[model samples]
Target: MSQGNYRVAIDIGTTKVCTIIVRKRADHRVEVCGISIVPCDGMSKGMVAESASVTVAIKESVEAAAADAGVEVNAVYTGLTGSHIESKNRWANVPRSEGMRPVTDLDLSAAKKAAGAIDLPDDRRLLHVIPRSYALDGLHGVRNPLGMHTGELHIESHVITGSISKITKLHNAVFDAGVRVSSMVVEPLASADAVLTADEREEGAVLVDVGGGTSDIAVYHDGSVVHTAVIPVGGFQFSNDLSIAFAIDFESAERLKIKHGTAAPELAGMKEEITLHPTTMSQPLTISKREIGQVLKERTSELFRMIQLKLEEPHLADIPTDRIVFTGGGAKLDGFLNIAKYIFQRKVRLASPRGLDGMPEGTNDPAYSAAVGIALWGMRNLPAENHVDERKISHTSENSGTATLANKQTAGALSMIRGWLPKRDKETAGT
Candidate 1:
């Protein structure tokens, strides 16, 4: 594709809708040319609850982003997440060609077909079938097997499937807003693309994204996503707790939480107190900081504990706590990393998305990590090669069999390597 062609990514998150525009440069680097975010009025946890409200919000965000980038967008790669979605790894075996020659595109295609053959509810559909790795004979971890001689080929993948109705609703909403849905990516996957490094993913790590209404987790090992799940809790729940406990309005409670909330009450001094304005009372009320901390700790700990339980699942046992990386709006909370460290009993660090140009200071906040990552993903995954060389269309059709897996693995591995490599060396390396 021409370097000037702009790609747009829309993150229809729970509490906010964000749109980002990026362009691929001659050097193959992606630059964030524009961004726009608006409060989500009719969506919750990445699902559209009110189509009209969501359509309006999406259109406004898109228009704002287009205006900033000085270009119009005809289609967008959207993000999707919710408690209803599920992801799992499955394996499939495909036989070699009749002559028992090297693995062919047909074999890869067969493997993908097998992986996508899982039984699901009538209202569900597969969103992504990401190959984790290929196995030739008994040798696993084979990244590319196109020309490799093997009698049997085995493919492992993370199959992401979601509610068909929800996905359809999202498509319709975007369509109503006068845009085409080029693709739909899982939210955690997009966030992981934006933040986590390759070494972290290979060495085993978990990415936790604490958005306004939900906490999404993706576990990685050996440079592939092993598990992904969502917890129905986030910063918004903390605010709700404060609002109810203090008998105050939501806005006031949010302010207090942002200003004074802590995940550990034992660390707060008993003498400390915070003022609260109750909804019914005429006078402001004073509440102990320790008490507020205790409440915050309870809810956050519950969320973390659920994450721990998910980690306990056999599929996620390889994830190491020492490699944990936290992102999202909630990661910005004061003392949150401390609390996460205490609960997980390991080193924890806040992760932010990088490698974009023209991003505003505040827009660099973790809250925009997913949106920015989506933009990067679009630039990298969209059919750029098709646009670049029309003559290569037939090659694209042949490679589509393994392109999804290869692209994701390449992206994941390159990101991990970039995080740990020396500045000069990483700059010279290709993603």
Candidate 2:
């Protein structure tokens, strides 16, 4: 019920919009206070197709969540994904003028800033500059260089960028809905944060979040993200394939897919048949369970091949991770893992949202992983921004004891705003 304790997240997907409000507990786990999922047709393949419709859906979803939580919603951490999303590793070196001094926090910050200063094309916007690792004076793979004596510090970072036009469209849509975007979270990162285990990340793993319109991929090793990508295929394509193959309406096909679809036909009663009475058909029609599975199987195989191709792309093939975790609605089909295992020939498992408390019944499925992850990301990272801002203000006020009255008033106003909405972290600029 308190303003500073609540964090809201809005995950705008191709098929649905999900808004969740959570409260941070004293134990550091987030408790879901309110959640809303609304059907949306305003987006296609993660991009806004109809801005007005997306705005209306965002407003409706936020209002419903706020009402359920009995709180006012003003800002949110929203998730972003699409084919336009791109990421690459960059490096930067910082030389300390204080010869061979212990590495300070300021040096690390400088390295990160330098690494993130890569020239981006005018059409692209930077989303996040995640620190991958640190190295000092000819040493590589140093986890933390702080307090270590070094004359020069080096930083490896992963820079995420997206199409400027697409990013602007999503931002405008959220703004038009009467809420400020506290941060724009990369969907794969959020999902990984929610579902991946600490061991998985440290030991190397891959997370595939197959959403309604796109499948997001993130590869992790050494406890940091090494590669990330988005494939332009998802649950929508599977259902559409069924619709086209069975000569049924989209809605009917969607229902049928959910009820009986499988990625492996032989495992799911290949000989069994089910009857359907579609709204478009006056008479009942007999549908084979195997046929449905066959259609999905082809698509599933193609998807796996696409994923393999993505992994095998230049600079991505040698990342050295065979463990793959699948999440999101698209991965919920029956026998989905069977096909993935057969195709990837690697360790594959389904993962759901973890590390949160008070999850509502039926909301712990993979479908809500990204939404839950966004809330968790906000809870973990947004507070750090506020802490940093407060530290800066305190240091300034302490150093300059003769602070003007206007400066004090401005600081007070900023403190009040920080209570409602934490400042965005500089490391995650534009997000």
> Which lDDT tens digits does candidate 1 get at residues 306-340?
88897888866545646678999877877788889
RMSD vs true structure, all candidates:
10.8, 10.7
Q: What is the TM-score of each candidate against the true structure?
A: 0.86, 0.87
Off by over 4 Å in 1: 1-4, 278-280, 319-321, 385-431
- Model number with the top TM-score: 2
Residue 12 Cα positional deviation in candidate 2, in Å, after optimal superposition: 0.4
| Per-residue lDDT of model 2, residues 291-316, tens digit only | 89999999999999998987886766
Candidate 1 lDDT score relative to the true structure: 0.74
* Residue pairs in collision within model 2: 184-431
